[model samples]
Target: MTPRQRRVAIVLGIVAALAAATALVIDALRSNMVFYYSPSQVAAQQAPGGRAFRVGGLVAPGSVRRDGLQVRFVVTDTVQMLPVRYEGLLPDLFREGKGVVAQGRLAADGVFVAQEVLAKHDENYMPPEAADALQRAGKEQP
Candidate 1:
């Protein structure tokens, strides 16, 4: 092969290798990725089942229950509610009638099994997912 043709082949091979590496990385990350959803979406069965995801909404009033290291609460978007089960100590900001986002997977029975729970940092600072959910729910309200 001419030197020019050999150089072209080397470059093409390098490009193909890079593309393969990128694809592999994306495939690996896809499994680890967690999507965010709202209680309304979850209630409507729009959220993906059996995958790790985030659900954000207001903590429903009178829904917080604790049993030693385990806690259960209901996240609501005013139109729908999703039950969440979490283990371990909750953040100080976690409370009823507040915004919260739980990262986990949905159980077969429909409850969210949270691996992590994050409460709003301040009264005026609801998570973006929670705010968007509330807005969407409000617009859908009759």
Candidate 2:
């Protein structure tokens, strides 16, 4: 084969490899990508059952119950509420009426099984989306 033909073959090989890599990355993202939603969104059925997602909202007042290491709390965006279950030590900052973010999948039983529970980092700082949701529900600025 001519030298020019050899160069063309190498370029084509490189393109094919890149295309394969891109397809793999896209497929991985499609399987792993998750979304965040509030209780209102979940209650609206915007969150599909059995789909993984992060729910951000306030730990609903008077909605926390504990059984040994397993804790259950209702997260609320004022307009709606969702129950979350976690089997671990609760964060010191985690309290009823405080903001929280729980990452997990919603079960058909109507409970969120949180793989990770995140407490608000500060008394004043909440996830912006949660804050916006609260504000939209008429509970803003403390």
Candidate 3:
């Protein structure tokens, strides 16, 4: 092939490779994306049924129950509440009436089966998403 044709072929090959790489990156991100929802959103059935997602809110007071390694609690945004079940050690900061974010899938029975639970690290700090959810639910944290 002529020099110009060789250059054109090289450019086309690079463009094709870049497109493939971009597609791969986008696919990976899409698959790994986990959305955040509030208790109201979950109650409205806006969260994905079978896919993993995050729910953030305040742990309802007097709602935590522990049975062996399994723990159950209720997360609420004041407007609505969601039941969450987790089977593992909880964070030291986990407590009732505090901010929490749980990652899991919604069970067929309407319970959130949490794979991981994150509590607010400090008394003065709550996750932004959790705070927003509460505000949207017509409650303000102290």
lDDT of each: 0.90, 0.89, 0.95
Superposed model 2: Cα runs more than 4 Å off? 1-4
lDDT of 1 by residue, 1-142 (tens): 9999999999999999999999999999999988999988998788898788999988899999999999999999998999999999999999898889999999999999999999988767988778888888774311
**What ordering of candidates by TM-score runs from best to worst?**
3, 2, 1
TM-score of each: 0.87, 0.88, 0.90
Candidate 2 structure quality by residue, lDDT tens digits, 28-78: 998798888989888888986876899998998899999999999999988
Clashing pairs in 1: none
Error of 3 at 13 (Å): 1.9
TM-score of 2: 0.88
List the candidate 1 regions with Cα displacement exceeding 4 Å: 1-9, 139-142
Model 1: worst 10 consecutive residues (lDDT sum): 133-142
The per-prediction CA RMSD against the true structure, in angstroms, equals 2.9, 1.8, 1.6
Q: How many residue-pair clashes does candidate 3 contain?
A: 0
lDDT of 3 by residue, 1-142 (tens): 9999999999999999999999999999998999999999999999999799999999999999999989999999988999999999999999999999999999999999999999998879999999999888777874
